[model samples]
Every structure is written in C-alpha cells, then in structure tokens.
Target: MIKQLPISVSGSRKYDVRSQFAALCYRIRKNKIQILLITSRGTRRWIVPKGWPMHGLTPAQTAAQEAWEEAGVRGQSDGRCLGIYSYSKETDENGHFPCLGMIFAVEVSSIADEYPEAGERERRWVSRKKAAKMVDEPELARILLDFDPRRPI
Candidate 1:
C-alpha cells in the first residue's frame, strides 16, 4: 500500500481503505492553467483532472492518465509534485468519499480540439488571476497564486 500523509483540519483527521488521488493541473500556452469545473456522474462540485489508479502505474502516472481522460489534453508532466489538497464526496447522502489530491505542475505543447468528457462542463486556459477567482477552494486558489511560470520547480 502507498503511504499517505495524515491530514488535519481544525482538529479533525482521516484515513481508510480507499486512497487520496493525485493529479496534474496543466498549463497550456503562456503559463495558463487548464481548469475544469464540474461534477462526477455522482454529482459534486470540484476542480480537478483526476481519477483512481491502475495497478502498474504510479500515482503520478495515473495523474497523467486522468488529465487525458478528463481534459483531452496531452503533454509531458515532468514537473515535480508541489502539494496536496482534499475534497469530499458521497455516493449516498449520509456516507462520504473524502479524497485528497496532490497537485503537480504539467506542461502541454498542444490541446485537443475536442474533449470526450467536456459535456455540460466548462473548460478553459485561465490566467492565474482568473483561476484564483473561479474557484471557492482556498488551497486550489493558492496553487494558482503561487504559480510562477518563470521559476523552475
């Protein structure tokens, strides 16, 4: 099993059988991050290019897969993982799927003209300032705020 770092918020913490997913938020031309805002078939508000892992791939590799699956963008994600954030979901009203996400810096030379999964969801290459305003999550916003294209990871 992969070791997960314990997360704490206002004196609460979590861990279990399922795991936190890792993903990359890609930057297309001119250091703009590609962000997707939408719901799962299960319906939850989130901003991510994410999914569960397949056996042979590492979390980072799985992140790359999710990027392609969710965003229809292809590129090299050789940047180092910067950090993690969490969000919660539920299949049923009372139960929840609390998830943590590791954010990585990714680069794309090109984006596909169409995304297979873009239905009802909005996708864009947003400037860091615009991205910060688009999301409610402070953590995701911080990632965009601290995003310096000229700096090497």
Candidate 2:
C-alpha cells in the first residue's frame, strides 16, 4: 500500500508524500562489491529497483521482489533497511508527489537472463562510487557511498 502523508501545500497546490521500498542489490565480484542499477522505464534515469508495499510481504521481501522484476536479481535481502531517501515522483496526471524510499540491502546471488520488465528497462552493475554518481537522488547516492555490508547501518 502506498501510504501518503498529510497533504502539504507548496505554493498554490497541495501534494501527497508516499513511501516506497527499494532494493540496493549488490554482489561481490572479483572480491570487489558492485551495485546493480536499472534505468527507469519512463525517463531512463538510473534508479534502484523499487515498488509499493505488497500485502503478503515484508518491506524487505517487497524490495527483493522489485529487484527480481526490475533487474532480474536473485538475492537475500537484509532484515533491516539500510536507509531512507526521498524523491519527487512524477505522476501520469502531470503532477508531482513526494516519496520516501526505504532501501534494503540485497546480496545478489545470480542475475537471470529473463525477467519481468526485461525489455522495458536496462540493468548494469557498477562500482559503488560510479553508481552513487549515476543516480539522481542525493540521499540514495550518499547511502551508496557509505555502504559497507560488514559494518552496522
């Protein structure tokens, strides 16, 4: 479910703030950690796999599912969320809504050759530093930069 915050007015209009779940899918490749990112279907902007909450799943599970559908990632999602980042989501009705994304760490085991959204999006594995720079969200980028699976969040 997309939980919207109390409407807030900026100028002459009001907007809702929703919360989403995202997966920070990563793998240890050649002894170095790499993050997987996918291009947004509409804008082709780099973003982590994310979606609204699922009824029968935990937040981590929801994030993991999104990773599977969006990036073809099979992995173990951490029990705890890594962090939260906020962005403005563009609506189909030509409006913008604020969204807070809870990011979960997913340690990827394998990537599938076929998955949902395969043709609609492009996925790539990149160095954390590069991934941090490629993403548009500042808070999400900061999370990527500070990521260390061995350390506590």
Candidate 3:
C-alpha cells in the first residue's frame, strides 16, 4: 500500500495523508473520453471520489478501488502515470481536505449496480473539457486536460 502521511485534518483530529489518496478516472463512449465527476455529501462540492487506502494495493490499485467505492464504477488503469496532486483533507462541512493528496490515472471498465459506501455522493459522465471547467483547483483541472483524447498521459 502507498504511504499515508500524517497531517492536520480540519474536522475532529489529525488525518493521515499518506494513508489516503485520490484518483481521476475515464471511459471512452461515443468516441469521446468521458470523465466521472462526483458530488460529495453535505457541502456538495464537485470532486472525484477518493478515500483511505487498503493493504496489499498499489497506489493505482488504491485509486481504482476508490473509484468503485465513491463513484460506483469499476475501471482498469493506464500504465502511464498521470502523476500526483496534493490537497488538504478534513472530515467536516467545509469540505476542505486537511492533508496533501496524491492523484493517479484509472481507466474505467465497469460500474456496479450497488453503492456499498456513503451514498452521500452522485456521479456523472462528462466531456474532458466540461469536467476540467467544473472544478476550482487548477492542478485538478489540468489533470482532466491530461486525459483529453488527443493528449496522451
């Protein structure tokens, strides 16, 4: 499993950054690469689904797992690394992450019928251009651009 770095989480206590990670995933449908965007509970902040890591999983595997849990979609991954980004993690209404987050590339393969975790979230398939514009984070928007069909990650 990837390392989880301890950091100040805004909600109730310190959170481990290294122990958790985030991921962005894509699926090609109708000749366009569609990115999956999610809405989190409470704050309704538009972001990708991500969470703590599990044992015996690679960072990419962890990312793929997060997609399944958070977005209800199953995906494979590209050998090409889309690279990492950082965010502060928190467990509160502000919805700000209180720790630095690392990002990875995951390829969408299938979406399950059931949502096993928090249903406080919903997901949608959108164009890379629209997906990039949906988030406020520049680095995250840039990550979406990297997934452009014409732009190789």
- In order of appearance, the predictions have TM-scores of 0.70, 0.86, 0.76
Top-lDDT candidate index: 2
Q: Lowest lDDT 10-mer window, candidate 2?
A: 6-15
Ranking by lDDT: 2, 3, 1
**Each model's lDDT:** 0.59, 0.85, 0.69
Candidate that beats the other on lDDT, 1 or 3, i.e. the better one:
3
Lowest summed lDDT across 10 adjacent residues in model 3 is found at 5-14
Top TM-score: which candidate number?
2
Report the Cα lDDT for residue 105, model 2.
91
Candidate 1 vs 2: which has more TM-score: 2
Per-residue lDDT for 1-153 in model 1, tens only? 234333333332333324544454555455445543334444534466766545556566667666667776666555356677766645453487766677765565566657777664445666677766866568877876687646854
**How much lDDT does candidate 3 score?**
0.69
Q: Cα miss at 30, model 2 (Å)? A: 2.1
Off by over 4 Å in 1: 1-18, 28-46, 92-94
lDDT of model 1, residue 136: 58
Candidates arranged by TM-score, highest first:
2, 3, 1
> Which residue pairs of candidate 2 clash?
none
Q: Candidate 3 on 1-153: residue-level lDDT in tens?
A: 234333344453234433456678788887889888998675677788777655556666777788888888887655344656565555644456545446666777778768775466878888888988987667778888776645642
